[model samples]
Target chain A: MSVDLRSAFFYSRKDIFKNIKIFIIITLSIILATANIIVINGLIDGMIEDLVDNTVESSVGHLNIYPDNNERFIEGIGIKEQRLATLKEVEAYSPRISATGVLSNKELSVSSTILALDPDKERKTTKLLEKLVRGAAVNPNDKNAILVSSRLAEDLKLDVGDEATLAFENGIIKVYNVKGIIRTGNLDFDSSTVIMPMDEAYRQLAIDNMASIILVKLSDKSMSEIYKPMIMQNLDVNNIRTWEEETEFVSNFANSWRSISSIISGVGLIAAAISVGIVIYINIIHKKRQIGIMKAIGTSNAFIFTVFLMEAAIFGVIGVFIGDSVGYLAIKYFEANPFLDAISQTWISARFEPQLFYIATIFSFGVTILAGVYPAIKASRVEIIKAIWGT
Target chain B: MEIIKTSNLKKSYMLGNVEVKALNGVDTSIEQGEFVAIMGPSGCGKSTFLNLTGMLDTPTSGEIYLEGKDVTNMNSNMRAEYRLKYMGFVFQFFNLFNELTVMENVMFPMMLNKRSNYKERAKELLNLVGLGDRLNHLPSELSGGQQQRVTIARSLANDPKILLADEPTGNLDTASSIEIIELFRKLNQEQGQTIVMVTHSPEIGGMTDRIIHFRDGTIEH
Candidate 1:
């Protein structure tokens, strides 16, 4: 028959049902590859998002301002209130003085970070007040009271209301009662944090209101690029850093992870493409006689080629579509019930990326089209007489 | 008037550097509405000459005139176009698309053309070929004779100017062969359909208007 493209398309689709084995194999291959890509990419993105959130909430705020040149600590809000509030990006700011000190009882001593900050302002910037595992939040009224992480307290074997002496730099020493125990999701930070009233820390360090750092919290961290320059332009400070800058480890991990995902997904799909290619090759070769008959009957080469190519494309689309639907269900399931980090006490959910679907669809269709080229051409160029004679 | 005429028709093969002439410098003609049979031994170039005449293969050297038009030099695509528009073919093996039903197979030739009467015409042809009831049956589901009937039905789908059959009953038993040859004789006598066939059977050849016997690629009578 003189087959038109429309007839060939419908014929090829119906023929796919006739050859169910090859159809099933090609469909399953695309499904497996597509599902693997979506799930793996979701997991990776989920981990990165969790890391960024935890870092921002635990240690760094949206931005950080250290002292100017030739100095380590900045003495209070060197940038005036009118100047700070005028930027419009500053949602809230926490001023704190940090020092490395040793806390000891009669039996043990461990080095840790001591932060002296206003309890009210710190609560607005971080989750310290909300994440208290035992005892109350830090008290600004008690000059001799301090807060410690549950990990740090465990390390020193200290509890709330227990008296421990803290030794600071420049030979200053003081004894204080532990008032609260807090647990942050980060293991490293949890094991080394000690908090006290800002006035008491200045007295112990004898630094005269020279706060070590001021963390500037923004309404949106993503707008740091626009706000950072404005903040820098407003203040005479040179050492300000954003949360993304402070958490370089997370960014590096995310970048490395993306490359790995690409390699793994790329390899799987290419293998599938080659497999589908081989099947198409076999199909065309086996049907050489039929193709020859068609050619002799005046069926155009282009029409025959379009038939096979359309068949391959339909395989890719149908398979990827089914796989994507199943994968989306998986993504939503994971999103609703996140994996638990028992040690950090955190819940992390995967990020569902729609681009994964777009990329997978395009790649799958591309693979089949590319693979079908040689076989389609071979089918189109069948030697009519030899093939019809079965030679 | 001659519907097909060949002048100095030649076809050869280089089998391992040895030249084997399948058809060597033979000239022949068949008038329109004539039923002709070609008889030859194996390897006497009967099938080669049929292929050259049908444009199924290019001749090694010769000029072939179809309705007084020189078609020997036409390209493969043009030859295919000409053949599709004006000729029908029946093969020994039935060569029906095994996957298609009898009806679909019958409609295949006309399907190449955008004809609206394909279904009704195919049904009419199948009924005429005594396979009207087996329209939905695949070739594998039918007897060899029934399958040959389907190919014959398919051969008339395009309503072409000429019908070419190459050992149309080579795979059939005596009874089926007689029936098929009788159908060809009926077609030639009733409809004035020009028919050219190749066969080894003298009984079948005797039913035709003329039988051209070939020996060493030339007509003996």
Candidate 2:
């Protein structure tokens, strides 16, 4: 009464119901825009997360202790292991010896990086054991057993218990039976890589108690930066790198993807705003005569303006609610059946970030309200004579 | 006692860069409970006079007084307030909100006035217009005469001191026009309702207590 909010809401409700088809169409457009934003953003977030997880969990541990400049390999492994074992922040550590080698199965010869590791230690430090797709994990005591990536195994025509001759860069040759084939979903790691017992590597590479790098898995992966200095303070290593530094390429890619996502979302939201604005403007135009009649009968301009604005708010709330529901369902579906990224060779699931939902809701609702302003003002400013007579 | 008065009321506007004087230096007054008709030809400023006196438009020059209070200089919001408190308007087209039922349409003005008893009051007014049984009917569902009755009921929603109608029966057939005129006469006689209506038909104009002839934006006695 007297153009209060309740009366305005009453008018808006009746008007919307009277034009239910138009209301549904406008609301559906808003829903499309909002869901588009959520799904696209979720996929990008999932891709970035998948890339980071594979880099940190499958290969590069949270912290890697590498040989400092001018040094070929890290010496004093026993002392380093003892110091690393003393730290509570370190979950597990594996010392690895790497040598470029050629593996041939008589018919095919492929260049590969032979990584020698302690099977038990590598299991605790990396996801290598869990990612094994064929045969059993290499046993630490079995000197003749080796592991090969699924891609390399395919190239060399090797399988479980199949012997392949490996010739190291130093010309040391030996034949080892493949114990396992692993697919970590990292194309580089799966393409040209082999795993063998450390003892076998020591004999083949002619190295004594030296490691190319020590991969240290932290209890909390995110604490790599903070714990890197703490581990360095305790150990004698001068070159400790955090996972972020080791995965700079992935971080750069993620940043680029984020920028692209923002641009697309910006365009989408603006389109949504324009669509809402045009619909509201048309509604006002159709109601121009009624508005003038109301004014002629002593209804205040504020009342007419409030009624239209309330109509827009109703559209926004309903549209955004349906949009959020649709987006949540889509994200859940994608989580169950992940998207396979061919370029990265990873299966990425949509990540449900509550912040994304909140942002989309606010933008859509706020934009709809803003879109209502001009039309509402125009309705309030209608000249009674011209509007009534259509002059 | 005089309830409405206009002195030297002149209203001019630009019609595509050419000046159109809708009302020019007119003077008139309606006594309380007076049933008056403004009789004029097409473009004779009868509607303009009604619109200006009803506070629906501003005058280019002159003064309008309602119950001895000068209201010519009031701003749009003030005019709307005064109009809500004291004036009611009916248009040639009936102008009833098609979305609202007859009961809701009658209740709208009272609601705008923030009257708590709008429902009962609207029912009473609709019953007076012989439309009590049609309260739940939309204006589109009703015949033209019935819709006009609803408009009249709505015009009385706030119980304003004066009702100004521009060609209230202009679109009605002869029988519907007589019925509307009879309803107006009944309202004037029974409730002492003040009415100023514009009608071009001499037959309709002859029924009012008085007729003020208008021609070319000026009133003729």
Candidate 3:
């Protein structure tokens, strides 16, 4: 009378424990696979977060606002104060004039995208001044002041307090003294972008009181989605863009990475499962005679099968514990001192998220149990006479 | 008072598509509390007869009666249940699970049958077989004769009606063989346990109350 369900487990515990080598091998395989998934997932996730953060801090703020007609890049969005009346969550907002033009110095000339912005309001919206590597931030009062990337400064052969000429595609030209050299490290932006005062830009491009776009800032980046509707009802629905929607390439890269890593983890799990299956199959074959004798002595076939499954589950639990412990430590280490990618100048941190832990545990157990089924069936179907004779 | 009676019992095997008869239409009977030994040369089907009588295998054709009830047609699982309840078996190899201690091996059948107080029963059986002090010893730790004693104890774990032994001393030396035969003789005489054993040695057969001779899968006239 086995009243206690765990009696069988304790009964056979020594049988599996005696085979320490097999347990060690299975545990190591699971630990290695689980740790790999955790670390790799964290690294990829971290890289995408860094890219989004850099973009938000340097250019897109949180949301972009435009005029009622979406197709026409509707210059100024909130030139009339009533258009932005409902924006309570907005931390900062700036009106900007944007154009693509050529910048020329005494020796070199290169085509670049130009932004005309208020130094005070734009400072609060985009933090354009904090990215400065040299000189000072552009001033709205100094109509002749311009900001350039260090990379762009080198490309145009211009320096701070140096004279430079800015030309629009519509054949308009203006001269200004270089105010700052900023380095955001975003390759496309760093290589070809320049900035000036909104009034000076509009006057030089033959524009009037209207600006090209309004960049809005929210306290939290995630709040942009929630507040987008409230802000959209006051303006044009079709012309509103959250920073996440505007940064399509980052999301695309993140999505593609997720797909590729999932495939890699899938293959790793299969390999681990196959390894476990092979080991357990060999164990069943080795224990064939014992299984036969158990059946011969009145132990049911189902009992033998259940013991095998229990053995696999034991291995699964131990493996998950060790793997998750190691993985959690690795994540913490990487979170504190991230893996640096010198090429992108970004720190890739490993996040110790609860979801990753849950997934790793479930995956390890699922594959281990699935591996046990065939061997368990084989043990239950053994012929008692043959096994006794062999013994 | 027939404990087991077999009528026209036959069993056949396939040896690469050729039929080989292991038991051929044999009719056999043994009374309750009888100590019986079936004697034959190797491959004479004496072991096969004991296996069929123990319900370890089903007959190819014919019937087996246990207490006047037909059991030859019982399914394997039901037959296993019957084996657990009313039959015990001792193999020539003394097939104790290598990992289990002597007492644990004795407790296996009782555990399966849900017999309460099995731990105490297993201890008593081990003490009866004179290995009481060796309860915690693994089978590999004991000698061949001691291990055989363990098997005998395990066979009687559920206090079954009949003990079926196939070449029980075939692997023992002369001294151990005589010792095991005397043990079986004592168990039958004192406990009145019905035992059907198959053996090649006539010297061992002489100790039993009855000897049934078998030749080429049939009882000798």
Candidate 4:
């Protein structure tokens, strides 16, 4: 009995090893599909993280506070002036005055969105200073010092120390030194945004203690949801949009990427399942007679199935490992490339994160094992008599 | 005393709307330590009879007793166990797994039975068959006669009470056939093994202690 079991194991092992070409092909297919899943998942994860980071740092807080007539800001001129006792309640708040205008230098002119901010207060609440790519932050004392996005600066052919005239509504023109160029990932922001001190912006727009919105940052992200209702009840606010609600465009874009990644991963998993099924089915067909001979010689169906399942599992493991490694390397390579920086400035923004690697590895391995089940079952159900007689 | 007995054994194959009766109401008996040759023309169900006796196939309607245990109604797994424990078969095609060495082939059945010291027993069998020096050779590397000797060693691996051969030398040349016959004769005479061999050759059949002629699925004499 021992001899029979030893021979069976030896034969099964030899059979598996002898079919190295099939093994390699199956492994490669699984690896390719797994790699695609991992890389796509990684990219989606990175994109979402980048979107959230940019949203939180550049514009939206975990929460937002505004006047009761804030809903009117979407269509027409909003609250011209308001006294917000925000310092006593929130962690930090930056008063913002924003409008669409045209920026011009000697050689070029472009339409841009202008933001007026209190530099000291904004610095305490936002990431504007850290995102500067070419110049210094806007001086709170210099009424004419303005910061422009990298794309806008490039379009107007303006650099640090250059003079640029900002033309606002009612023929108001403010000339300012190009204090800094910043790059945020949002294409809309990167191409057409300019920042100036709040007082200077109020003067340009002919406003008094007026602002477009008041941005708030809290100590805890979850606190936004809790504090939003209290702020609404205490203050005569028209609407309260959280950072999550404010960054709808970025959120939507990230959501779409997530959907696409899921679809791709789903398709990859299906293809893997089919590939494994077909390969194992073919293997069963090829070895039908051998299977019969083994059964006839007293080998059990369970044992035969186990051998095939082991082969499928081996394929899955090998493929998942190789694919995950390749996908990780690809993501890393893209993250570190200078071209990515250029692309981020021009199109979408990105950051290199290690967390994506772990997520990808887990997803790749999981999908591979899921894909192996059908093939393993089919292989196990091979009928001994029919297999022996080629039926 | 009879070691194997089958009563009213019947088998049929359905070949796409046509029922081909492979065996019909066959009754036979063989004693222990007896060398018997079953002889028949083509389509006489000689091979089918061997399959039933070896527990490789089930009868359509019959009762079979091996060592006085009724086994016709045994399930597949049980039949396999019985075959593994009490029977050994040599096929016409030499049905050796091509990848295994001669020693490994001989050791296969013994391993299945969980027999200890398989190498020692395998070597003894190989030496008994005069192929001890060729243990490491693969089936393809040996001549027809040598390959049949390996099959013989394999069949004897489980220490079965009865050995069944279905044209064991059918594919071999004249010298190989005679050599296999001589081996079978010696195994029966020296080791006192009960062997039932099916052969078409009258000359070889004549050498057995008893020759049962089969015709139309029934043993005549």
The Cα local distance difference test for each model comes to 0.83, 0.88, 0.82, 0.75
Candidate 4 lDDT, tens digit per residue, A1-391?
1223445456656555656787787777777777776667666666666667666877776666554562413222233112234434476767687788899998588988888888887887888667888878987777878889988988988889999998896588878889889887667788999988877876777676555677777777667778888766655565778887786777788788879888887787677767776877776667677666666666555556656666666667777878778877777765565234354542222343566555545665565555555654665566644554466
lDDT of 2 by residue, A1-391 (tens): 2567766777788887787788888898788778877888998988888889887888888999999889979998889999899899898999999889999999799999998899899989988778888899888788888899989999988899899998899998888888989888888889999988888888878788799999999899889889988888888678999999998999898899999998888887788778778987998898789999988887788888898888889889999999888988898889889978877667899998998799889988898899889999999999998899988
* Alpha-carbon deviation at A183 in model 1, angstroms: 4.6
lDDT of 4 at A222: 66
lDDT (C-alpha) at residue B70 in model 1: 95
Comparing only chain A of model 1 with the true chain A, what is the TM-score?
A: 0.88
Give me the runs in candidate 1 sitting further than 4 Å from their true place: A1-3, A78-87, A103-110, A128-136, A142-165, A173-187, A341-345
> Best lDDT goes to which candidate?
2
Better lDDT candidate (1, 3): 1
lDDT score at residue A160, model 1, on the 0-100 scale: 88
Lowest summed lDDT window (length 10), candidate 1 chain B: B106-115
DockQ, per-model, please? 0.48, 0.64, 0.39, 0.41
Measured over the true interface residues after superposition, the C-alpha RMSD of each candidate is 2.6, 2.0, 2.8, 2.8
- Model 4, stretches more than 4 Å misplaced? A1-11, A70-92, A104-111, A133-135, A150-165, A177-179, A219-240, A317-343, A346-391, B99-104, B115-124, B130-138
* Number of clashes found in candidate 2: 0
Instruction: Note the clash tally of each candidate.
Output: 2, 0, 2, 13
TM-score of each: 0.91, 0.95, 0.90, 0.83
- Error of model 3, residue A380, in angstroms: 1.3
* CA deviation > 4 Å runs, candidate 3: A1-8, A67-86, A104-108, A133-136, A142-145, A150-165, A170-180, A220-223, A236-238
Q: How close is chain B to the truth by TM-score, in each candidate?
A: 0.98, 0.98, 0.98, 0.97
